[model samples]
Target: MENSFLNRIKGKEFIFSTLLVAFVTVIGSFFRGIIDASNFAVLFLLAVVLSALWWGMASSVFTAFFGVLAFDFFLVPPYNSFSVSDLKYIYTFVGFIITGVIVSMVASRARRQAIETKQREARTAVLYRFSNEMAECETTPQVIGAVRKNVGELLGCSTAVFMPHKDGISDAGSDADFPLDTHEYAVAQWAFSNKKPAGSGTTTLSAAKAFYVPLETSLEAVGVLGIRTADGRVIFNTSEMELVTALANQSSVAIQRAVLTEKSREMELAKKTQALQAALLNSISHDLRTPLVSITGALSALSQDFEAVDAADRKELLQTAYDDSLHLNEIVGNILDMTRVESGNLKLNVRPCDLRDLIGASLTQLKDKLEGRMVAVDIPGDLLEVPVDFSLMMRVFINLIDNAAKYSPAGSEIYIGAKTEGNMAVMTVKDSGFGIPSGDLEHIFDKFFRAVKPRQVSGTGLGLSICRGIVEAHGGKIWARNNTESGAVFFIRLPLGDAGHGGRD
Candidate 1:
């Protein structure tokens, strides 16, 4: 139950004062015959002390007034009437009143100081609680929501948090009931972007309905916090502003920590992936090379004994051995290229080169595979030269051509074209083959990624990945897009070299 002001005044101290006054009156009445004038004075002084001890100065003054009245009524010479025949009784009453007033004055001053002290301690406790709650928040949204709720309770206001967004500022946890206006959002966005407080109590846009304080840390402003007092005025006093700023700083730190943690996780995952790729490369290289070496050695030995071997057997052995070597070489190359790319060790020797020459070299290298496939090349004489690493660029074209041949039906047309687009030299290798599945378009360049439908084709699924790495190393980009007219079109875009340099070769 609440202790009312009157109840506090009439508590134990008030009762004690009343009882003491009554006791003194009774004693004076009983000792009237035995007690001398000096005894009355002593009894009055005892009453004054009791009043000061039990009832504070004000109560003491009241008690002294009653005590004087009792002294005269029951112990004065006239015996229990208001009439005091002696003038000394007047002196005694006056003396008692003066003492009570002095005591009350001193006690009242002490009580005022004590009350002020208690209020200060209460405010300190509130600030401590606010700080503790803010420290426990982790993300920007969490911190904003917590600050809004706590500030609303602490300051007795409707609080909102406005975070910076691409369009403007959005309220952190606002519902339909607390819709934000466009001007308020714009104002909040301005405050956050500029790291300044505006609206209401602030100097900038003081007429604004709500107070906006920038949530800033050491690095930058994270967002803005807005508060509206119950009376519809902003309540961003100095202390309140300081508390809000502190909360905002803590929030910024939390956001920064979260971003750093996410980046750290990404780096760790990349490291583990690199380690796995290295192990796989080691295994593939070892397993594929052993049989390849043995088969090649057997071929050499048989060729030396050609006269002793049957003609048909020698031809079959030579052909089988040749095909096996090619397959093993392709697998080994894919593994090495993948490992290099994953380790970030692939280096490009970029120079201005003719796209026609690059395409021709790739075609020559894959001639045996493309023997039954129809190849069509369309290159203008005035086509711009592109800056690229000749050897790696050729390999990219070779991979694309070989992939096209493997997927295209026998005797299907394959198109190779070079053209210029804006500042880029564009080369497209298109084939009338089974189009890439729509779901696999994005992952086509990912290591070890292959479409399920293409499983029948022989490949380690690293060809496109290697092609991407090589093209990117030369400051170019390669991508696959399904041609509306026919099969998939693999487009390579390389920055055009200076006209005077022709093409880096």
Candidate 2:
């Protein structure tokens, strides 16, 4: 309420002091003889000072003019006109004008400094309010909404938040009337990925209408913040940018905290599950191993007497024992791998390997699942080598390919391609199969994320997630996207080993 009142006063044409100066000048002219001449000059100087302090240089000059005119007409020898009989009166008028001008000039300078000081204080107050609000925000959506509303009100602009995605940045809190354009999305993504500012008022892409700032934390960038003024002039100055950076930093910290809390909860749950798994393993190991040992002893006795018994019965017994052994091995391997991955104890032996050879090995391992599918290999012979844990990367590819084969029709085409783009080696595995549902796209790489819509498929739902873990540990990224034509495509990008320290091979 106090702010509103001050704003109203600031918007006025003249301040109270300016009006007071005019009032005193008029009354002083009327009561000329009663007022002492020398003292009246001091009063005129005070009026000029007040006018300048409240209403600026123009008001102070007008006050000085009126003071000189009043002194000459009412206080000189002539009572109602500008005629001055006494020559000493000339010095009085000259001295009065000089004093008023000097006082007004000084007052104007002081007023300007005071106004600037007040504006700085107001800006700081706004920043404080913004920081406090951002600290309370938990999720990305909440932060985006709060920031948009607050920034729009504070800076008087239409605000937006754009989050970086595979293709571009999607609007976080945008209305239909102000939808983000493609160019804006690209600029926003660039800013977000690089943790730099772009668009209006920045060195890069300053011709763009909107300003893009990266919502960067100490670790990494969360997203991009966009703000556009109604008048289209960039409203963000150096101080404003600093304030925005501070706000973004606070928001980043809050988001990081929320994510960490969620992960901690998940870890606790996993620990509990691990205890249950250990008990189950203990029970299964004892129960199943005893039966398997008895069956193997019976098979050995039967094999020794095979020549005297029926050949068909002996063959069925041997095949049954072998299949059970293979099934038991697979279950044990899966359990061990899960435990290693969950405990973060799966160390990778990183090395430079031919992507073509890696892809071929992965495909060979899953050849049974591929069945009648046409596996088209598009990797060039001269493709650059990638730095990776060869065995881990093979497992990642095999899992992705196996997943595609399971969801796709027998006769569908599966394309595996690799190439070098920028400083990364890009690989894509695509299948002409059922595309991922829109709702499941975001969680495709989450542990135990299965498509509920297609419940008929049998899976443990940990393939993609495990693949993501393996790729990320090797300083690479893995993500899934729906193909434009049909089916789903999983993309992997590894920094080229030959590039530089931060780049993957």
Model 1, span 375-460: residue lDDT tens: 99988676356777788888899999888887777799999998887777888999888878888899999876776446447677
Off by over 4 Å in 2: 1-21, 36-38, 56-58, 65-94, 105-125, 138-142, 164-172, 175-179, 186-207, 214-223, 230-505
lDDT tens digits by residue: candidate 2, 429-464: 998888899889899887656764464454455677
TM-score of each: 0.48, 0.46
Error of 2 at 349 (Å): 46
After superposition, the stretches of candidate 1 with alpha carbons farther than 4 Å from their true spots are: 1-260, 263-309, 452-456, 497-505
- Provide the global lDDT of candidate 2 against the true structure: 0.74
